[model samples]
Target: MKMRSLIATALVAALPGVACAQEVTLSFAHWLPPTHPLQPTGFEPWIESIKEASGGRIAIDIYPAQQLGAAADHYDMARDGIADIAWINPGYQPGRFPLHAIGELPLMMSDAKSGSRAFDAWYRTYAPEEMSDVYYCMTHSHDPGTFHSKEPVRTPADIAGKNVRPAHATMARWVSLMGGASVQVPAPEAREAIAKGAADMITFPWGSIFIFGIDKEVKHHLDTPLYVSSQAIVMNKDMVEGLPDDLRKVIDDHCTPEWTEKVVSGWVDAEAAGRQRMIDEGHTLYKPTAEDLAAWRESAAPLTEEWMASVNKRGIDAQAAYDAYVASLREAGALMGEN
Candidate 1:
């Protein structure tokens, strides 16, 4: 009896070390504050899902608010293993990701859920070459974005001479095309820029302005779906490739078109809530008339032509990609306000 007891104690003592040896922990990095909807409503729940799906074999450590690095550096941080995974805004790097600019195009899709699913599907076809250095998890966008400014901007003419904060390269070009000076400010710093008179306007998803506390500084809001910001979550190639089969499958399961939609759908509700909040606050909200929408569309026409021309130079069939995206949006019933 004494000999049996000693053996059982020794086996129990070794169990924790054995479990630690078999478990894997991945680091996830992003720039959003902890209280942002994307964190608590989207990513945190998704992380829990991954942990449950992996049966405790995989664990994830989340670093929010650029704890690992700057927002623009997130892609390379994951690529270089600064974090095993990162939420990256490809548009932040400008021309480096022209293909991704499809999601950033003016008046593209209506809501984040359908748009993100389409983006994930479309980007998968190009991920092999465009995001070759990293393991592409998924691509998503915020709900349609619009101008939040100090003064009412009802037409293209109002944009001229306004110093606007652009969320990405395409928007930057759009600002320049409309004769506005582009003020480069990441979302977190946009409030200060506007407060200091460095930027008179900014383009963002409806809810993000409120989440970032920029709503307090801006008195005018464009009640139009002007554009959306393209974003992705990627993993280090080496880390993905090195994972055991079961663990890799867990990651793969979480990185699907369905998951992309799930992650971004919450933001759609948040956008509506934010817009309503602004209206309740008595901020000047301009709802464009049909003629106003027509003029704005006409003004943005040249940007599409320029984008196609640039992508063609890189040997991409840009028109086909754009056409496919439009088709997907139509099929999903996510055209202008259809959602």
Candidate 2:
């Protein structure tokens, strides 16, 4: 024990920064537990990449598995400077991120990369103003949401009366429009809800199917594309403002609007991993027929108009934001794997 301690002390002494230098350690908190393989292989690599890119002068302390608080409380935590940084799901607190929720509208994303690009593009084109409080780093989604249900959802009518968890308010509305009872719950909490008969199914990025152990509770996964909800990594304004210009530039370089799409591609990868898990666990995966998709689209259309009206009541130019999002989606379509 003494020899081991001596070696540790010697190593710390050998590294000037490791010894007595009070390295400015920035804390980054997220809701996922460290055991989620996606973090070490995916999100954690981004951390390592930034550190290597910065030559270790800046160190980030990552707190995952909701070490700080519940998922829904993360945004309030970040806004209040509970931590230097965090990845927050805007949908977790519905009213606070009213405008940013536009990304969650139906069928806006096709794949993670394009969805991310489209999300980044959408944020730039329509909702940059919504993120003024924090240093907004990126906007992206899980690959694309799909239905993990107690029963197969191969047809539109299957949604009727089922307790489905939707990604956003609009999604919940969409479910309700199609006759499902949309429940709003954090994905982390969805597993227990399903196992305990609290929720019948959920529409989320495929990853939650595995991350939250939904495969064991739900036997079927709908193969049709659902809209992607935007999630972001943000830094407290005070911490961001205090950074040296060079260090700030480093963050800027890494967290670029374009780089954001690249960095967040993990979400899609995580979703894919979840889908594969579903297959491995013997869950039935089904795709809706063309006629069924048409039925879904027709049923869900009114929710879009309803969203516009709600956003309009919030005093921003709803038409402009809506139009911009639609236009950006059209432009983002090719990138999103749409013809």
Candidate 3:
């Protein structure tokens, strides 16, 4: 069946001046809810753009809320052709792609737009090597997140002995480093973890707390841009390679750094609104003092050391790569708090 589809695509490419509308359709899978901002704001628009660019030769159908596969399996789904394109969270599979993990570091990104631009550009340089299994499209950022706990977490000491549902692998290590138990779970299951007493707090972006229904489970919120998770859209290599030339070009056009910003823009606004909603609802949103931030910064420094060591073992100049990443974020004015 796959061979016949490839042969038909090849025939279309070989024909002399023959054109067809809506001749190619790709399956795009993601784990976010259908109502998530990324749907209407990001993927839908981008899909339309691709169809328009190809003169209606390309169409992309999105399968949301893990309808195609689990969130952690999206990367492999794209690589193995389970989905032609899949949205993935690199940090979900820890230590697998060390270079990409740098994006998960604490206090790295500020706003989603500039961060998306910076991260997409920077990761392209390494993606050919680090994420070689699939066609690396583009990367986007969530607005940075902080601690939303059942109790106040003003200082690093406050995290002691608590169970936390971390945003990603980096945050899990951060929780462990602060003497908390990292209650490992995906975003969808977060509220259940807290309600069932498996976790007492969570590190998540502002608006997602409500979206995931975790807002009812925890009260005290640390109003800080602690960290942002890195996510990407990738395409199956075979599917892309087998597409007609015009359709392939359309796909390439949508995979740029500029597109990353467009995809993340709606999500950015939603997160900002989520933050304000928490305040309006009378949640105890604590903006950390300069002293408290200093302590948090001091505590997080070791995670970098550990990250550098892990990258170095892979034969890359870890410090240079880390510096380059920071430089990219700085150039984009997206280094957390700049905006």
Winner by lDDT: 3
Candidate 1: worst-modelled 10 consecutive residues by lDDT: 1-10
Answer with 1 or 3, whichever has the higher lDDT.
3
Off by over 4 Å in 2: 1-23, 125-128, 333-337
Q: TM-score for all predictions?
A: 0.93, 0.86, 0.94
Give the local distance difference test score of model 2: 0.72
Work out candidate 2's RMSD over C-alphas.
5.3
TM-score: model 1 vs. ground truth: 0.93
Candidate 3: which pairs clash?
A: none
Candidate 1 Cα RMSD after full superposition onto the native fold (Å): 5.4
lDDT of each: 0.85, 0.72, 0.88
Ranking by lDDT: 3, 1, 2
lDDT tens digits by residue: candidate 1, 212-257: 8888888898898889898999999998897778878989999999
Candidate number with greatest TM-score: 3
The regions of model 3 sitting more than 4 angstroms off are: 1-22, 337-339
Tens digits of lDDT, candidate 2, 14-63: 88666432124577888887876547765677777767766674677788
Clashing pairs in 2: 32-65
